[model samples]
Every structure is written in structure tokens, then in C-alpha cells.
Target: MNLKIDIDKVQYDASKRSLAKVQLNSLWGKLALNRENYDEYAIVESNEELWGYLYDKSFEVKDLFCGTKKALVRYKTVKEYNSKISRGVNVVIAA
Candidate 1:
């Protein structure tokens, strides 16, 4: 017995194709995301917490805006937060 499968000859409904495309794109986008390149925003309520992020060598403070009860910090990690941890953002294989 013999069987053949041709992916090029297969046909799919418009809705099915759209759904598959969206799912695949989302999967790849998540894999390609680099957390280090993105900045994080946090609402620091205490001077210790605010100063901790400001003085840390690993983090680069972008902006500081003070509010009534808290301060908003926009910062990005300049160095690896944890040397033993892996971000799992594999851009090479995903591309």
C-alpha cells in the first residue's frame, strides 16, 4: 500500500486560515520577545523601594514621577538580574 500527502494541494476555509495565522504569529512573537530590551514601570510606595531601584547597578532608571502617595518609576535592566536564570527568549531559532 502507498499513500501520498501534499501540503501545497490542501485547502482551508478563510476563517480557519485566519485563525491558524493568528495562533502561529502569537506563538512566534512570544518566543522572540526580549525582556531585557523592554522597560518596566512600577509604583513605589516607600523611600526604600524607590531608592533601591534607583541605586541598583543592574537597573538603569529612566524616569521618576512622584504622586500623592507613591512614585512611578520607569526603568530597564542594564545587566542580568540573575546570572543563574534564563529568560527563555530564543530569537535565533524563532527567526
Candidate 2:
């Protein structure tokens, strides 16, 4: 599967803690599935180390900060994680 990371066009105002609207795509959906299947796939922590495994298709990790397990799978970055959470999507870090 192909994965792409796209940032929302609208910048989040750190001071205000407001976020811009975002649209989720198919690739993102696939990522979500991957995240949800962490239990079956054996997800892990350690972002730096996980990259190699993710690239090799051996393992995966979702950094959702305070998100639910489902949201973390689709989101690949901290920003994406936060954006999904802001939109009411539940994202959580999982291994």
C-alpha cells in the first residue's frame, strides 16, 4: 500500500489553539485500517526506530498523543494526529 502525508492548508494558530478543516482521503483510510489492525500486526512505540519497520512492511506505529487507537492508525504525523483529534476523530498512540 502507498501512504502519503498531507498537511492541512489552513495553519493552526498556536496561541488560539484553533485548527483548520481537513479532508481525509483513501490513503488515509488505508492507514487507518493499518492502525486499527495493530493488534494483529504487532504495533510498537519508538517513532525513529519504527520507520524502518514501516518501510519494510514488517510493523507500524501510530502516535496519536491523547487520541484513541483507531485514529492513530490513519494519521502518520503529530500534526495529522492533532488535526484528526480536533475534528472529533479519536486518535491514540499504539504499538
Candidate 3:
């Protein structure tokens, strides 16, 4: 048997990987087999500190999602980390 693949999907992921040096991938849904209650994990390594606060986990998270964990964290350079921190923003949703 032969399998068909979507070339665009592969290219999209490749581009995302290249641009998103850091990614937070979670597998809680895959693990629990429940997609409705699944949450997303984020990888953030933009600016070194984002004004010297977030780099060290200074940002407080209230009612945090305690069911998931970070899968991977990547950083191409300290400069990239700094840039992400300085220019990036995260939006948290209550579960």
C-alpha cells in the first residue's frame, strides 16, 4: 500500500520550526484521550529578560493550568531569546 502526504504541511512545520526557535508542546490531550479539556504549552525565549522581569520567571500566573508540562525549549541565541522576550507576548486562558 502507498500513503499520500501533504507537502504543504511539511513545509509549514519546517518554516515554523525555523522561525519559532522555542516551542512549548504539550501532550495532555494525547495522553488522556480527551481533546475538549486540553490546554496549550508555550515556549518563550525572546528577549533576555523583557526589561529584566520575565527572563527569571517574574511574571505571576494566577489559576495556572497544573495539568500540563513543558515538552521542549529551544534557544538559537541569547539575542533571539532577548528579542522574543522583548517583543513577544503571551495570552493565558483559564481552564
What are the per-residue Cα lDDT tens digits for candidate 1 across 1-95? 79998999988799999999999899888888877678999999999999999998977999999999899999987875455434778777578
Instruction: Give a tens-digit lDDT track for model 3, residues 1-95.
Output: 89999876765567778556433333322233433223333443334433233244533322222224322232222233343322122233111
**Which one wins by TM-score: 1 or 2?**
1
Collision count for each candidate, in order: 0, 7, 11
Best by lDDT: 1
List the candidates' TM-scores in order. 0.76, 0.18, 0.16
| Residue pairs with backbone overlap in model 1 | none
TM-score of 3: 0.16
Clashes of 2: 7
lDDT pick, better of 2 and 3: 2
Give the clashing residue pairs of candidate 2, or none: 35-73, 43-95, 44-95, 67-91, 67-92, 68-91, 68-92
The runs of at least 3 residues in candidate 1 whose Cα sits more than 4 Å from the true structure, single-residue gaps closed, are 1-3, 6-9, 80-87
Model 3: per-residue Cα lDDT at residue 34: 35
Best by TM-score: 1
Tens-digit lDDT track for model 2 on 26-91?
Answer: 434533444432343334455643455446443344443322332223223223333332332233
